[model samples]
Target: LDRNATMKTRLTTLTWRGSASVDPRFSAAMLPWSIADIRNHESYVTLSVGVEDGVLAAYNTDFELQFEHKLRYILGYCRVIVKQEKGKKNADFLMPKATSTRPQPITIGNDNVAEIFGPEFGLVYLLKNPHDPLLHIHFYECEKYEQVGWVSFLIKAMELGKCKPSRH
Candidate 1:
């Protein structure tokens, strides 16, 4: 049995499911995570990222607008996991399979940055910057994936220019 395969199966088992009612209190608590704040170019986006034992995980909610002209809303969770390799000073990212029926092991090394973006859930950028020496993650919520993609592209372009100094 492959290690990555086993890890993927284990992660799928940790799926969270539940239901709740809409209330003004709940809405008030989540207002900070709204797409409007991201659109306004907020300086900081708050997300929960933590490490326990040998596993590092980040979790966030994706708001999906439904019904006619965004009258209704649905919520889903996106989780990213990275497991430390035994005896090695590197970790492997665990990418979730698109569907529950198929189990595919997709893992990336720590050196490579991993990002997940969706039309509903927003974007998660995972990277370690040398200047900070800590895990740097930038999350942005958008009603449409196109908006996230556009911003991501611009950020990447700017980063490239900064790295090369003459590529602009």
Candidate 2:
């Protein structure tokens, strides 16, 4: 359970609308550590994403949109999952088999969209193996599996515990 896997990794922050900003409300919310502390070696991450109504876009580090296009259907929901590199020698990361079967979808709507163009949710990732730090966020078309946009993140171990550890 204490094994360390070696691989070349690059972690970057997703820049949205010229800055890496999270919904203040989402950031201010609390995490339920009591529920999380039950499992040994378990950790979690809260992801905040912004979904736009038109022209799904991907941006480069310069704060410029790299890819933008209108999809056939409107984005309805998304899923966040913990992923790990396929092998020590492989650069590709894969979502675990167990997670593939029962991923909870994160949905944005009129009720939850707190502000115009500022819809957000606290997408939580309950990591299967606490040491492996990666996340895949995939958005899909309304009522369908048509992917609209996606982002991947490789969390640095040092940044994992920025929050004060639970006293439990």
Task: Pick the lDDT winner.
Answer: 1
Which runs of model 2 end up more than 4 angstroms from their true locations?
A: 1-50, 73-77, 83-168
Count of residue pairs whose backbone atoms collide, per candidate: 0, 0
Candidate 1 per-residue lDDT over residues 135-158, each given as its tens digit:
323343444444434433333433
Give candidate 1's TM-score: 0.28
Clash pairs (backbone) in predicted model 2: none
lDDT, candidate 2, 76-154, per-residue tens: 2222222224632212222223235662223333233211111121122222222323321222111111111222111
TM-score of each: 0.28, 0.21
Q: Model 2 lDDT vs. the true structure? A: 0.24
lDDT of each: 0.30, 0.24
